[model samples]
Target: MSEKDQEVKDQELEEEVAELKDLEEQESVTDELTELTTKIDELDDQLLRARAEIANITNRNRNERELLQRYRSQDLAKKLLPAIDNLERAMATEVTDDQGMNLKKGVEMTLASLQQALKEEGIEEIPAAGETFDPNFHQGVQTVEASDDVPANTIVQVLQKGYKLHDRVLRPSMVVVAQ
Candidate 1:
């Protein structure tokens, strides 16, 4: 080939090389943009999950606080049970004089009022006597031979009254079981 023809060929080859380089640079830029977009989406998803977790934790804590407040009177009502038992025992006693009878009446009214207050506060007596004995609500202090009238594991007598605060037992009834 002639010198001019060779020069023209060289110039064509150089232009093609420059075009290839431009295409490679554009592809590299597009790949970098795609990677950055993916990273942004992943970060946004993580932020949403963290916000949901925070909301759940806040709701759980609020429910716990409400439950605590609802049962706030449980301890005080439990402490007053012994005093109620004493009043009940006093009412059971026989009185001859007018003053003694009046005192007994007062005791009865006081006991009634105390029971009402406890009931309002969600404190209640656990049933024991004449019912089937349950370990959850009744504590068997003594066991007697099973009789035809009372089946095995039946509560024969309640030695001490049991009480509960709502569904939770505060004290188990001390009782005698037929077994």
Candidate 2:
């Protein structure tokens, strides 16, 4: 071949190599863009999850606050239960004289007022006598033999009355159970 033809062939080979290099660079840039887009999508998904978790936490805290507020008087009402029982016992006593009768009447009025107040605040007596013995609401202080009339795990008598505030037990009933 002549020198001029050889030079032309060399120039063609160089142009082809340059074109291939440009194509490779473009492919690399496209691959980089795809990877960056995938990373951005993952981050956006994480941000959405974070926001959802924050919302859940906020809702849970609000519910807890409302429950706390609703049961606010539970502690004080529980402490007053023993005093109420004593007053009830006092009411059961027989009085003869005018002074004794007057005092008894006063005691009855006080007891009635206390019960009304407790009822308004959602404090209530736990059903014990004639009910089946439930360990959740009744504490068995003594157990009696089961008779034909009374089944096993039945509450025969409530030794000390139990009380509750809403669905929560302020105090479990002390009771005698047939077992």
Alpha-carbon local distance difference test for all models = 0.93, 0.95
How many pairs of residues collide in model 1?
A: 0
lDDT of 2 by residue, 66-121 (tens): 99988999989988998999998999899999999999999999999999999999
lDDT of 1 by residue, 10-113 (tens): 99999999999999999999999999999999999999999999999999999999889878887887789889889988987999999998998899889999
Q: Largest TM-score belongs to which candidate?
A: 1
TM-score of each: 0.84, 0.82
| Residue pairs clashing, model 1 | none
Worst 10 residues of 1 by lDDT: 69-78
- Highest lDDT model number: 2
Candidate 2: stretches off by over 4 Å: 148-151
